[model samples]
Target: MVMIHIPTHPLVHYPGDILAWIAASLAGWWQHRAFPRETERLAQVTPPGYYVALALGGVVGAWLAGSLNTVPSGLAPSHSIAGALAGAIVGVEGWKWLHGVRGSTGGAFVLPVAVGIMVGRWGCLFAGLADQTYGVPTDLPWGVDLGDGIPRHPVEIYESLSMALFLLAYVPARLRGRAWARDHGFHAFVIVYGAQRFLWEFLKPYPKLIGPFNLFHLICGGLIAYGFVWWRNGGVRADHGAQGSALSVSQPDDEPVRNLP
Candidate 1:
């Protein structure tokens, strides 16, 4: 079995960091132009300390979850996108609650973050078997040979493609002033991504957290539940104006609302 090996450089070793920086930059640009008031509101509502707290919480949470999930299963404990995402969500929510800030601050991040994940998965795919992100064996024509002789499902590619499809569907709907897409964009992404992740978890070889579900499956379930509850409890209404109306920053003196970020 001739395994495929890609030589690593400094950039390759920190793909996550590079992708995160890109995502942050893109999201900030979107917010600055599309939702300046929202940005200003966040600056006021979310303290400087909250950023530090969120960063620390995200790192610690990712490390802890990754460690727990990998070490217990006899795999080398390493960083995982799932763990980082889950940790960031928890950290931000905790900080929001502590600061009494309500509504989703993640609306602007939906597209950028999705793009980042889709790009980052490429790194996982090329990392080969050592990264532990490889999938189970498969006879499918397009199956990848990740250092193993037997062809295997390219699960990372599957996830990246799924996210790409999601962006295709979501971006158009959001651009067209779709009611649900405009008002509940963040929750919409969460629900869709969570459900997709839940389905894809079955293809992974991670140890089960319950009977057949793994830790990531459980995390996906939690995200789905949170997304549902958040939407059900009128979270969308709080952020947007009228249903079907384009989302815009609040302004004085009755100027025309700008949509498209």
Candidate 2:
């Protein structure tokens, strides 16, 4: 047997892992836009507040999930948290400026962010820190052995799956002009991601003592509760007319609703 050694040093491997995956995912997302069917419709679709909310939520969620916890498990430490926040703030504004205050999904904002996460988490998994740690141990064949005296759940995989499913749900609903598609899609993403994250946190090991629960769990639970309340309040769709109807961002008088059915 040729003696084969897995690289024991994390520093040697992490940068490439994160950089490559992130770069590739971004490239793929951008490339997908090149296809007219996938790219053109988004142009007309003005970015609603949901985009802004998700970006802000991601920053706050990522930060609280990473920093307030007993230890870091994902990409970027408190510093990454700062960077993520700054990037989101700047990115949204910059997007507004570039695309005009009337923003459109026609660009590469949403997909790339999700893709970047998918890539970045891989980095965390390899680096073996940050939000990468979590989930109950499983005897399933796919379980990862972190060599810390236990076979752990691969929480990152769970997140990646969640985001992927969200994107998948969003794209179709967005295109067909589903009723409350944008609103439900965006808010649901937040609520679902938050809830799943909270549940997953239960399995991971944290440094601080929080009576069997962590900060992320509480926050997620809160968001999920809010999501439920939010949905009950007629959801994002209630604010608008039915599907295929023009959404009057301004006062209804401005749009001149003609014989609304």
- Which predicted model would earn the best lDDT? 1
Badly placed stretches (over 4 Å) of model 2 are 1-9, 12-65, 71-110, 129-138, 147-149, 207-211, 234-240, 243-261
| Model 1 Cα shift for residue 237 (angstroms) | 3.7
- The most accurate candidate by TM-score is 1
Candidate 2 per-residue lDDT over residues 52-158, each given as its tens digit: 75477557655654565533544344423223433354455455555433312312344555555556555555554333454466665566654344455777667
TM-score of each: 0.81, 0.57
Candidate 2 colliding pairs: 42-106, 72-130, 73-129, 73-130, 73-131, 73-132, 74-130, 74-131
lDDT assessment of candidate 2: 0.50
In model 2, state the lDDT of residue 163.
70
